[model samples]
Target: MSVRRRASSVSLSRYARPGTPDYVTPPGDFCNAFWGLGDSGVDVLFARMRCAMTTTEELMSFWKERAILEERYARGLADLARFTIGKHEIGEMRGALDTLKNETAKQAEAHLIVANGIKTGLETPTLEFLRKQQQHRREKLTAVDKELKMKRNQEGYVVRAREKYEADCNRIKDFAAQSVLLQGVELDRLRIKHQRTLETVQANRRDYANFVRGLQEATQRWEDHWRAFCDGCQDLEEERIEFLFNNVWAYTDAVSTVCVSVDNSCEIVRLALEQLETEKEIGAFLRTYGTGNVMPDPPPFIDFENPDLQYDPSQPPSSHPANYPRQSHRFPTEDAANRNSVGSPTLSINARRASMTLFQPSAVNGRNGTARPPQAVQGGGSIPQSPSSQQRYSGGSNGSHPSHPPHAPPQQPPPPVPLQPQPQYPHPQPSNLSTPAPAHVPTSALATAAATAPAAPCPARTYTPIFFSLSPVQAIFGYTATTEEEFDFQKGDIIAVTATPPDGWWSGELLDDTRRQPGHNVFPSNFVALLM
Candidate 1:
């Protein structure tokens, strides 16, 4: 039986007397019988039965004696159960307390941060600085406003001045037009007066010239008649004195007529002189009238019919030939001058060929008797001679023309000139073509030196046909992982390997126990081998 059941049966035995009906124990009284037994009684029974007793009489000797002991035992059992329960409660409480403590600490830290924020906000000077800046901005705005107002006032004044200037311009334009009209009228009047004065002067000069011519003719006639009268007086004086007196009277009449003519001539001459003086004054006045300075003398008169006045025939053709007929003579025909130009020396074909041969002895002679050298034409070197020249030169006899007609015999060959050895001069050979001998080195040593000379480094080699290996997991993921330990391997671990030396380095992911989705797995679960 279990220890508690055994103990309870023994306690019931101690509480009951032997052979009693309670000792016999009815089926329903079994629980009560076990409850009436004390813990000491159970210990005693266990001792008498030689069973090991975990409870003792000392344990049952408390207040209420056996009953109190029983109560105490029950209380002890309840307290132990309570203690075991409290241990689990304490563990749960401790976990909750730890969580609460962490939350509290976080809250405390947050509060400290808030306090620091408040302190920082209170300490900063930005608001005061902003206020000063706003005041400065207001001052600048006020200055700008004042300047704008001044500018507006100046612009108003400028507008008023422009209006006044426009009015003045209009007035000036009207005055200028009126002044131009007045000036034209005055100029016309002056011109008319000048023309009238010019006509009067011309008329006066003509009248004066006629009057002078008449005076001269009358004077000459008077002198001739007086001389004739003197000669006649000597012959008629004795024969007829009375007739001589009448002749003298007629002579006197003639003399009086001459005197009257002279007086009329003198009056005409005086009027002409006065008119001429008036004309000169009028001309001077007219010349000074409009011009600011005295008028210059008119150009000297040119004769229209003089040889110098005639047009020069040697002048170049005029651009407007229709207006100037003399230029038509310059158009001469080329045919008219060609005969004169043709007499000048020009090369014939033979002459040109001869000249070419003289200058270039190596030129190929053509059938037409023209020597055309192989010209160094552009885009290439000299042109090749015709194939006939090569055949002729290649023939055994130099004087035999290969293409000549059968009737023509071969010409005799020129005699060979004797050769003389030229005097040789000791000249240095060019260094590039003439290799220098090695300085006293043995042949074997020279060969060894040549063999030992370092050759240029060969280009770096590259690996080809590379192969890769993957772990089992990597094969599922279509990727491979590099092994962390060179020798160790796991079934699911990824291993990135290559057959060829890696172009740079091999790198891949590592696989752990963590499960991953298909296609998401970066590492191989098992080793995989790949062939290139």
Candidate 2:
């Protein structure tokens, strides 16, 4: 079975109505209200009233404190609004930001107004009314209590008056009895006593009646005043509740107004945000502060010892003067500094032929055992020889040995052999430039003539010139056959490696292609083994 439920009611407003002057009729005598239900009831009522009063007082105090906080906050916010944010803002952003600050200042002023309103219109009045209520309550209570005390005193007076009146009546009855029992002089005395007692009773009775009537009047007055005081106090309490309720409404209104003002200020900030052009600023910043459009060049290697010799970074590495030499197994000559590159106009390559015997001219490079002598070319002048070559070939016509140069070591001549007749060679004729000279000539006569010539030539024998593939050397040798590229090379590249010793070459002089010694001490020392 479905359980049906009532529809929920609409939520009540947070604000309450101010229902003032809730008149309540007095419960019996207002003065006796405390004691009517007993002392314990009085304690409970007092505690409840105290709790209610405290609640109201606390609410007022809280509102007062809240006002103080709002005032301080307004002051602080106003001061903060005076400062600048995003000081470097530009264009519309600048104007928009200024508007934001101005709007925020207005918001602060609104808050200040709200705080003042609470202080003057809510907290001030509520507190003042509470103060007056306390005083009025105290005064009313005092007046009621004062009247009650007088009424109680009147009750005591009435009791004494009754006692006095009854005592006087009893005394009058005793006098009457005495009058009935006496005669002559005693009768006259008794009659006088009786009249006096009667007179005293009448006086006491009138006084007692007056006292009773005064007590009754005082009670009536006190009761009336008590009821009025209670009603008045009740009105004050109700007024206090209504006043506080109204003050709460005022407080909420102030807060809501301030909140709306703050929201307006935030709306100004929103406008500022809308005017912001993030991309524009970012692009402008990059254009202003960026180094350049191109990437910078990488750092070049520099020599620690000669930093100034380093190449410029702006230039290509090829433009720098790093003329790296070619890597080769070089047999450097003794005059290394004087050595010429292969490209030099006159490159003199020193070669050595070692440990080989030379035959008589008649037996070496001869056709059919016939000898031919050296001849000068027709148009070309006599070939120049190095000083080293001249020293090796020099021989006097008189058959005497020549002395070696002082700096040069003495050469050990070949062991002497049996004399053989050397063939004679004819002198060259200019018209026959192409005529082939004999491969061999008389060593003694050729050396004699070479000594007299500008640079000596070797007595033509079996030795052959080792042809080099170098272009310049080929040109000198009249080789003009081909024009195609023969090789390629780069800086720091190796072109060729000269002869390296076979593994067992431990003690011999370096040799050339002819298998004859070139010279003593002509080898690259680093490649040769030292003798003990």
Candidate 3:
């Protein structure tokens, strides 16, 4: 086995002779021979030693300086990372730096292997080894490039996420601004509606106060009339009793009989007193339930074309006769006459004929529903008036006009008169109740008139396209509702209109039952009307 000599031990003769022009000195041999003992003496030796020492000193100083530079660079890098990343992210950044440090150490080890192999080579430079080392270095460089691209991708994800968050924040702020604007508009509309309601309430209060005053006056007048009638009856009864006592025997066959007749008259007077007391109770009821104008004189006939007339509570009913004309007949039209003939309030020819036949029971045939004509009274005594006609007679005269005296026999009573031909006069015509007005009339007078009339039946719940004007009273009718969702109000309740819908319906709330909870309900507009 042979060992290779150092480059300085290589033969000079194999290259070229010293004298030949083609000869060249190798650097190591030339450097060694120049410092050999045969050349230049002590001065040369000193210079060579000093150069050798200087090279050694420079080599040691390079390594020492490199270590110091590396330490300073490491400290500067740590300070720079802390300043940029802050304390929270500093730990994460340190971990990444540690990974870089490990990779750099691996690269350094690979470079050291390449350097050692080059130094140990004894022949001509190993080109294959150098090529392999270059290839390995290129592969390490590619790996470092791939790691850098991976870190860049991670950073890009954070940037994209931040952009999305910023966009969402901006959209939220815009929505909040839009919501604030819409709420402001709705608030304004509610405020205007509230103001209108307040005004309506004030007007209603004034009308209510006026109604109360009128009711009080009406009550006072009725009380005065009742008191006067009672005083008149008492005075008349006292006078009659004095006259009867003075001529007791002349009037009847015995004193006991005269006394019995007087007792019967007193009993009739007691009944009259009871009727007057009943009327007094009715007056008290009217005061409590009355909410409209007190027009006891009479209800006016409503004409839509005429301007509304105001009801003045201060004026007496007698003063307003021109406004409310008395009807010539109880039923204004002939149709009304025929319709009411069976249960009519006032006497007519048919009613009188029926009455005349009643006193003569012998004229009526049993169960066959037939009657014979009544003959005139045999005596001069007058035929008795029916209960309907009795309403017109004075209180004291009613008892004396009885057909049969308490002591007289039934056989001796007066006979009935034959039926007389009824006199005919033209009947006053009533306006068609269903006709709609062409334009809106002022509500004040119409409200009073309707309130004065008896309540009418609720109109049918039909939807139609007809247009009409409605006074306050004309718009107040509602039906007796069976269910809560329907127009649930009393049969004669007055509904207050709040709004009208385009669907041919009106939205209203019940005002008649004050205790009922208030709520809006819809009803067909055509179904509602004033009492008139």
Find the candidate with the highest TM-score and give its number.
Answer: 2
Clashing residue pairs in all predictions, respectively, total: 14, 9, 0
- Candidate 3: where are CA atoms >4 Å away? 1-186, 237-249, 253-532
Candidate 1, residue 268: how far the Cα is off, in Å: 99
lDDT score, candidate 2, position 18: 62
Scored by lDDT, the top model is: 2
- The regions of model 1 sitting more than 4 angstroms off are 1-89, 92-102, 105-112, 115-119, 122-124, 178-492, 495-532
The lDDT of each candidate is 0.31, 0.47, 0.34
Least well predicted 10-residue stretch by lDDT in candidate 2: 472-481
Could you give me the TM-score of model 2 versus the true structure?
A: 0.39
lDDT of candidate 2 over 1-532, digit per residue (tens): 9995442232122222365323424434323343332122233333434555666688788878988998999899899889987698655667777887888789889989988888888877777876776686578657766877788799899999999999988887787778778899989988888788788888899999999999999878866875676566556667777887887888787887787677657755654544344445656666767555454455666787895685566865332233468553563343232322222111121121111111211112123322122234456443211111112223432232222111111121222122233222223221111112222222333334423434322222333232221111001111110111112111122111122211110112222343342221121111111111
Question: Model 3 RMSD to the real structure?
Answer: 62.8
Which one wins by lDDT: 1 or 3? Answer: 3
